[model samples]
Target chain A: MNATIKTLGLAAAVTLAAAPAMAQEKLKVGLLLTLSGPSAVLGQHARDGFQLAMKDLGGKLGGRDVEVIVVDDELKPDVAVTKVKGLIERDKVDFVVGPIFSNVAVATHKPIVDSKTFYISVNAGPSNLAGKSCNPYFFATSYQNDQNHEVLGKVAQDRGYKKVYLLAPNYQAGKDALAGFKRHYKGEIVEESYTPLNTLDFQSELAKIASMQPDAIFTFMPGGMGVNLVKQYRAAGLADRIPFLSAFTVDETNLPAQQDAAIGMLSGSNWAPNMDTPENKKFVAAFEAAYNTVPASYAMHSYDAALLIDAALKATGGMTDNKEALRAAIQKAEFKSLRGDFKFGANGFPIQDFYLVKAVKRPDGKLQTEIAEKVFDNYTDAYAKECAPTN
Target chain B: MTATLFFVQALNGLQFGLILFLIAAGLTLVFGVMDFINLAHGVQYMVGAYLVAAFSAWTGSFGWALLLALPSALVFGLLLEVLIFRHLYDRDHLDQVLATFGVILFLNQGVKFVWGAAPLSVSVPELLSGSVEIANGLLYPVYRLAIIAAGLLIAALLYVLVNHTRVGMLVRAGASNASMVSALGVNIQRLFMVVFGFGAMLAGFAGAMVAPILSVEPGMGDNILILAFVVIVIGGIGSIRGAFLAALLIGLVDTVGRSFAPNLLRLVLDPAAASQTGRAIAPMLIYIFMAAVLFFRPSGLFPVKR
Candidate 1:
């Protein structure tokens, strides 16, 4: 019986080694996003962008078929953990991706990592994982949680915008954003407001912010709440009086709903729709042509995530069934990134650029993003250095 | 502290409170009278919103859409009562809560299946499209004032029904002691149907009225329902009067706290800490108010005997 079991194990090893030769088969990638209740817009955007990337790659990845298994995290970390485990255990996906909120991402990271399944985060970069918990299996395609806000803090400090009013939805992300600003900015803060996580009414809060007459208003409302705040902010007529700076709220998803009201709003991000690179330009045009809508930042990062996976797949010579070999191949910088050449940091996050984009009304009459300033070029996140994984 | 800003926020609070009352009045009545804890009440609001959105689009008139939606919302609520809620009355609170929670899960998902996950908003008619000046340079959305006015009118009408009418008397009687009313030969099953149906329409009105302003998406009612439960507990379950006052108080406290709390705290604490503290505490103001009320008045401020 021992000899028979040993022979079966040896046969499995042989099959793993031979997986590279039979690499042209379909590769399944698990896509987990917050697909319901307040975060649907984000999930929908991610799905659209991921699907678009598949289309751009000639509807295939790494000379093989790519199948995406999408699941809704529902913005709950425990639920996200369960859903991710289901994806790995039941669906048996090759790799798990996504979770736009940092809390959910962090919650599910342990199970995926313990299982030795590769994970590529599209959004929600928690500081701890970026620092201490950083494993080779975990990679962040999106900016770290504090990185974008840190840039906004610098801008606020550089411009000497004292008495800034900060607004965010009441959640871990909101707390992190406010903390992030404090870590960088030394100026006097006039007010800070945390509305309910899914609050649609922002008039009262806006009234409060306007009353303060802060030098600038920094906010982090995402999804439908962002749309509500932007529209009501205009209705309250706070434009030009108090400059609005935000993250996640002023993007393509809410832009259509906000229309002209979104014009002149400033936001910071790692990527924008009009990023003016051959890859990004082609991606934008193709996405617009296919979906009849402009891709938001959520979509862009998710597309980059898929392409990153695809690049790793190709570099591994299409061998994904051989998990160890595929992991090693993907670890190297093989993806042609839309945002220039940036390799993964030791922590699995890419060394990437950041930009401060202005919400501009293009001459063609659509609300568009234009680069107001470049925050960083091929910059590493603050937490990356702490992530020294002992081999 | 400008008058315009103050007036707008005060009124915004008032509007917010009034809208909540419409929702809470029904919820509190159900809890107080039936002793059945229902989590699916929020879906009724969603149904009303979706109904108005669809019917308005079909008829091209907000008035007719609302008129048609009221009956539909009531019918849906009555159907839910018959299918699920009636059985829960004799069961334990835990069982009732779990069963109703399941209904919430099914209905929330069902709404998504029927209406799709995308948010739907109602269009304000041409006449009520812009703001009207309630005070100098204090232009309140005419529609909002109309909401406040309509809500108060409903509150008054509800008061009249609960106090002046024969059915309202029985409703009050049933709320205090359901067994007594049953012993008196009232058709208790039909009464359950009426109260549940009416309660749903009230929640539905809140949804339809606010749909033009708020996005009508799935589970929108759930959050407000939590606040409404707090209201019912504070005002005295089964007491429309209690719901009104508690709703207004909570509305004022939440709105005013959110507007003024940070600035108020900045006077004492460091600016950043104050801001952080303010945002964290703002949403809790109502629940705090509720807890205080519960602490002092265990049965609620207007508790019916049952």
Candidate 2:
């Protein structure tokens, strides 16, 4: 009996000691996202969506146990670089996924890609990354930065809007947004106002818009800025007079805060909560059940990123060491994306359909964006032409 | 058309300035009287916003929410004073800044823990829900106008209280010389508590009032706090009148500069280049104004008569 007790104690000790070793063998992933301030909701959704996918996969990726390290970028590019270096060197993650904002992505891109680890950008597909800077190791499950904005540009043209006022934060993504809109829009631009980021007050901008009396107002204010602009726009009674066409200005992420003010607001997007696809329906239901909030494109794209990784790993027979094989496997991964008929173009950015979505309060009282109509089919980014095919 | 646009922008500036004054008033008072750098004062404003948002959601009425939020904010301010800030009074300004900055980080996380990271909204009250024609063909939001009116009323009340009341006199004296006031046998501790709590309430009030218009989210107070500091610095460290005037000036400069900078720059540069440079430079105008003020008057426009 004494010998049996000793043997049992030894077994327990060995298991306890080997647990961390087991963890080391698990697939390591670094999740870097804007997890602070007003934009934190976007990151939270992304994180939750990724987590939900992991849970659904029985806590494994590519038939291997997985470990996720989440770090907040704090919406600071400098901070993101410092933290991402730590993720690469110290944690030594196999894959680095992240960054809801373009600036942070730009900041952390070179560091991660220069290293051996693969980068799967769940959000923030900066135009430059889609063009000449595209790398085989970097895959963007999300659509390119300008595609959604391009949807509204085309919509405005089709609707016969003669003049539109454009407003966006003065940044790379904002400039990209306006440029993308102008690509499809042949209308006269009454004015282009690029406010500083985190500009909550838009009364002056609205006043300018009112004076200009444009046929439509197009903007790209995301997160809290979106909530404020939508509310202020309604309160100023401009919503009744002028049509508001935007991308990321009135979406699921900020719609809860925007509520009635954002209702009827038209926005350009790749996918909505109401997109009718089996994969999307499953994603939305699972995401809603898990997080109790409607999953935005940020969440949807991140979820797709995980599936992409899994599919690639499966194709490689769970091998992560062979760089060329893994790269080709990821490129050719036949993962069913939440957004219908998704595929990567030459630039490693997704070739996907774009939609015109509207903010509406569902019968269940949740405010979410619903697909109003398809704007573009099998849309590939214009920047792809600038990129040499990795294959 | 330009004149009309200018007039409308000036009104927007006035409204924006008044809101800034509401926040800067308390901040100036606390800094002046206690000689304490409360970096957490901005978080206190954030708390007020959150409190009102929560209460408004519960009560289903804006009036009720504001009524409940004000006292809760006062109590929350007093609680922070009693708990954390009470010990830091004797510390050097650097220590106080570090300690209060820690408080800001803590409270920001705390609010997120309590109220999730998602932004919350408080609907505009029915009384101030729509826009009214403020000029021929120019419409201004009624809620914004109400904020201006409330700000003006509070400014008037503050001017009277600081100039006329006994507590106000004590506060001014404390700001000028705390040890001297203490030597005069007044309970300086109680006076500090009162000033600190009152200042917190004022900041809370500012946050609650703007909660209807702004998204109540974590770190919402951070940007405005920087603006408030600029207001106090330009207005003078401890002068209520100075803060008020400085707040208005900063607001007008910010609003008007943002509105007309591109047009002004268009005189010297192409339209695209002008708009780009103007947007880049507009946000810097307040800092420039502050630098000019400090250059001309090192102790601020109306320093305490020490």
Compared with the true structure, all predictions reach lDDT values of: 0.81, 0.90
lDDT of 2 by residue, B51-166 (tens): 99999999999999999999999999999999999999999999999999999989989999999888899999998887888656568888888999999999999889989999
Candidate 2 lDDT over residue span A1-391, tens digit each: 3433454566667797754454336789999998887688899988988998888778878877888999999999999999999999999999999989888988888999899689999888888899988888888988788899999999999999999999999877788889999999998998988898888899999889888889999999988899999999988888978999999889888988899998898999888988888878988998998878889888988888889889998887677888989988888899888888888887788888999998899999989999899999999999999898752
**Each model's interface RMSD (Å)?**
2.5, 1.3
Question: For candidate 1, lDDT tens digit of each residue in B153-191?
Answer: 999999999999999999999889998999999998788
Identify the candidate with maximal lDDT: 2
Per-residue lDDT for B37 in model 1?
Answer: 84
User: Which residue segments of model 2 deviate by more than 4 Å?
Assistant: A1-25, A78-92, B265-270
TM-score of each predicted structure versus truth:
0.86, 0.92
Give the DockQ-based CAPRI class for model 1.
acceptable
